[model samples]
Target: MATVIFTKNLERHLSCPSQQVSGTTVREALDNAFSDNDQLKSYVLDDQGRLRKHMLIAVDGSTISDRIHLSDSVNEQSEIYILQALSGG
Candidate 1:
């Protein structure tokens, strides 16, 4: 199982605890993690089931490239980090 960790900033909005979920890809892992928490899922993904513009995911220290499908691979020891992207002008 992969360990999913939500950022502290995101937790400020809602209670998103770290979870150990089973999956071989980022999407599957997140689906398992969000199975009981639809609100957190909504916060991370858009209506089209795509990653929201402000949401970011890092799998074992590297950002994911397939935002729409979240096809990035993961393993049992993987650490998946989910966070809101910061932007400033």
Candidate 2:
């Protein structure tokens, strides 16, 4: 199982705890994490099922390249981090 972690900044808005989920891709792992929490899923994804512009997901230590599809691969021991992207100058 891969570990999915949400930043503390996002925790302020909802109940998001680090959870271990099963998946080979970022989308699968995220879907697993959000399976029980539709609200969290909405916060992270838009109506088109694409990653929201303000959100970012990183596999291991490198940021993912496919935000729309979240096709980044993950291993059993991979660390997946989901966080709100900072903005402004």
Candidate 3:
């Protein structure tokens, strides 16, 4: 099971209080996490279910390019990190 870690900014809406979760891929875990906290779905993804422009997902330290396809497979030992990108001058 892949372990998903959410940034502090995302902790508020998480149903499970832990910083990490277990799943087989970035998408599956995110789906499970969002299912538990539907309110957070809109915050993390766009109306098209794509990673919002301000959000990013990395697997085992490698950035994911297909935000629309969150079902990308991940290994049990992989570490998934979800964070919001800050934009400004």
The best candidate by TM-score is 1
Let me know the TM-score candidate 1 reaches against the reference structure: 0.98
Q: What is the C-alpha lDDT of each candidate?
A: 0.96, 0.95, 0.75
Clashes of 2: 0
| Whole-model lDDT, model 1 | 0.96
Give the CA lDDT, 0 to 100, for residue 86 in model 3. 82
What's the candidate order when arranged by decreasing lDDT? 1, 2, 3
Candidate 1 weakest ten by summed lDDT: 40-49
lDDT, candidate 2, 8-77, per-residue tens: 9999999999999999999999999999999999999998889999999989999999999888899999
Q: Name every residue pair that clashes in candidate 3.
A: none
Q: What digit string (tens of lDDT, one per residue) describes model 3 on residues 1-73?
A: 6677778776765543433556776777788667767667788888887888888888878888788878777
Name the 10 consecutive residues with the lowest summed lDDT in model 2: 63-72
**TM-scores across all candidates?**
0.98, 0.97, 0.77
